[model samples]
Target: MLAALPVAVLLFDDEGLAYANPEARRVVELDATAASSPPHVEAPAVVDAVNRARRTGQAIDCELERDGRQWQVSASPTACGQVGVVITDLTEVRRTDTIRRDFVLNASHELKTPVASIQALADSLRLATERDPARAASMLESLEREAARMSQLVRDLLDLVRLEERTGEEEPAEADLAELVRTQTTRVAQAAAEQGMDLRVDVPDVARVAGSPGDVRIVVANLVDNAVAYNRHGGTVTARVRRAGDEVVLEVSDTGIGISPEDQQRVFERFYRVDPHRSRRAGGTGLGLALVRHAVRRLSGELQLDSTLGQGTTLTVRLPPAPTSVAAPAQPPPP
Candidate 1:
């Protein structure tokens, strides 16, 4: 029945309102008895759409905001000199569209920076080749760096898309948390050493988790890389994994520049940098923390950050432990 339909529907003719479903009445907050007379709805946008449909003998659609809600109002003319109106709630859909638009704009802006730098450097190099050999070599180095940065950015964006697609739909397998942490720490230890920072890693002897090994490896690598990359020279970077009751915890701490309370809240956002220039100088793509956060989420994990702006920052991650049948008894890893 039209009256029982979920969508708001109204039928009107040259005389007045011929019929209005219950939903239509509720949407515009009109009384059922008012159906005999044309409602005095003062929304010019919807009214104009209906009038346009009647005058042109064609369908018209418009979106409008009223009473703190967004709506899509459509008017379709009928053969018998009548118009049928349909209103759909567009609040959530519009919000999603806005977010998507913003993301694309931000990503474009981010991509543009390195590309512009590369182009400028290339032009300079071309001119320097005929004028100054030293200048040309310097320009070539700069161009290489910009190209690498752009490559990293594209890779991280793709990784983010894949991770987002897997959120809440992960298929986990039995993985050794201890081995993952230990191996990742080894991979980044050289970088930390080169920066004159200490890399200390501690893992349990045989802590097992249920997660995609590749995804979990990525999470460990990103966090450790961020710790070393953001840390100050002669500082300390520590990574550890331990069992906390039913949960497994992975923590990465850095004795480098800490994040302010304000920036801490947004650190997980894609392409967010506390110090854009400094992060860029450190060869960071600004997507590391975002990737880490999303990957952890896919594994059903919680991440926490603790920091004092001038002291250091620590990121703590907790994940649901593998089933008892899969996990081995926990013990501290070798020193």
Candidate 2:
């Protein structure tokens, strides 16, 4: 790949810049006569890596700073008494990795609580058999409740994992978007009814998308379910589907306490909730938006949200249109 041009490069020795590739000079923020200048440390991790690569012949690889943005830095010893450094923008990868790691750890920690509680209660019940049947029954009831909580947690974990895997498969299909929204709206209507909330649907007759029906249903259900579950005591949940040019848009809007601007970015994170106490009381897994994001990415679509604190939130999903060619029928052989 010598033919493949890079974005930036830098050469440093003795903790000072020696030479730099044109792209590297512009990107790494180096000026004229930088060879005599110091190599600025953007991150401690990267500085450590550089020190390690200097002490040893190993390469230093880490995220560094350039123009206040994160970039991947790779430093290695060169043949001519110089250190070769390569910088690549890794903001997206770093962000995705951070979210993924948080998801795994949070899911484990959340699921472990109920399981550990149940285990403790069971042990107590076993040892307290001769103490009092009433107390033993109470422990048994707590155990059952924790057991159910554990079951729900486990189900949500599995659902998150399944969605995580399937949503990256890039499977696309032709289907009616309006019908999918209507179906999901009908399904969640009963759940909304439990809270005495009104659920309505406004679907265009022929909105279509180029995505798997199962995945589309998932996106619809999660959005609608969140709207209903997080809504006020007597709120309204609306599911609307339409098309704008070549994009099919599905929106789920609710009259609930909306999200704040600061927390809006974190809402799509797995196991993240603006109000943890209320989320737990409402029995949410906090993986809804995360799943929706993955589904949208796999479907080659875009998912956007608009919300105002104390007003409401709207989730808008736009899916690309499917191609309109049917497979040719099998032709009979001519005798």
Candidate 3:
């Protein structure tokens, strides 16, 4: 009967451990034949719960943490003074709760920024239009900018939700990484030129993967756009596509102010910025990397980040190559 149960179960008598099922022994990391308490299950709360259940002949419940994992623990007293203990793993449950909490808080903060700006801009425009037409025009421009920002934020939030809800049931199709790299690089070349930066594109004749074309483009566009946006004047950005075994790789490297170690770990988090003030001034919504990460996951790909404090940052992505039989029709190389 204990062997069929899902949760870990153990019985403790006055001597120490009277009985421990396989689940209990595995979770507690203790010898089932040992007559002492488990060393790894040393949470004081568990001990207290067991002692209280024995002393009062009443049931007790508590939470215990061990080795970075959460466990729900319950102790019930038997008629003979033995304690029946049950433990349920709660690590994944706690993780879901944390993700939900952070999403709500971060979403609220991001939405509030542009909404507040739009409101303040509207008030300034109203007052300035009556007395200062030139000031009113500037306020109107500010209002438009804030409105656009809010719109973009909403769009990005929707994209994140869609990615999170992905079912992985969509049929895959051939998508050329080289084409995506070339198209995205060209689209941003003008922007890079305007910023006095050079954009370099190096790609193979064809590098294809099995995924949605639109999704691939989104990934490439965001990476290339960020490379251009974060780069310094006269700096250079490089986009590359190549094949590694059964995988195709897409890489974007930028000569911008690199991310600090602390920020690098959180750069993929929604609305997380290395420098909030600088990011805002650079017109960054802070959702680009987050979206890129989610899109890559949906493609069953891997993303790697390499950066230094003052040098630059590089993002590399690898995905399974499209099957030869299903590869897209070959197109002429870009001139």
TM-score of each: 0.76, 0.69, 0.85
Count of backbone collisions in candidate 1: 0
Question: Any runs in candidate 1 off by more than 4 Å, and if so which?
Answer: 1-7, 13-44, 67-69, 80-82, 115-144, 166-172, 194-196, 232-234, 306-308, 325-335
Tens-digit lDDT track for model 1 on 1-335? 88888888888788766777887777767776665577765567767888899989899999868788888999999888889999898888888898788779888988898999998988888889988987887788889999998998898898889888863554548678788888988988787888899888777677777788877887888888888888899999999887788888889999989999999989998778998988888778888999999888888889899998978999998987778823355554549
Question: How big is the positional error of residue 6 in model 3, measured in Å on the Cα after superposition?
Answer: 4.7
Give one digit per residue, the lDDT tens place, for model 3 in 1-335. Answer: 99778888888878667777788777777765564553344457767888999888899999878889989999999888789999999999989999889989988988899899998988888889888988987888889988888888798889888888989478758788888888888888887898888888878767879888877877898899788888888899999877776788888999998889988889998888877887777677888999999999988999999998778889999988888822333455569
- Candidate 2 lDDT tens digits, 46-95: 45765778789888788767566788889888777677777788877788
**Clashes, model 3:** 0
- Segments in model 2 whose C-alpha atoms lie over 4 Å from true places: 1-19, 31-66, 69-97, 120-172, 204-208, 322-335
Report the C-alpha displacement of residue 57, candidate 1, in angstroms.
3.7
Q: Considering summed lDDT, which 10 consecutive residues are worst modelled in model 3? A: 325-334
Residue 293 miss distance in model 3 (angstroms)? 1.8
RMSD of each: 4.1, 8.7, 3.4
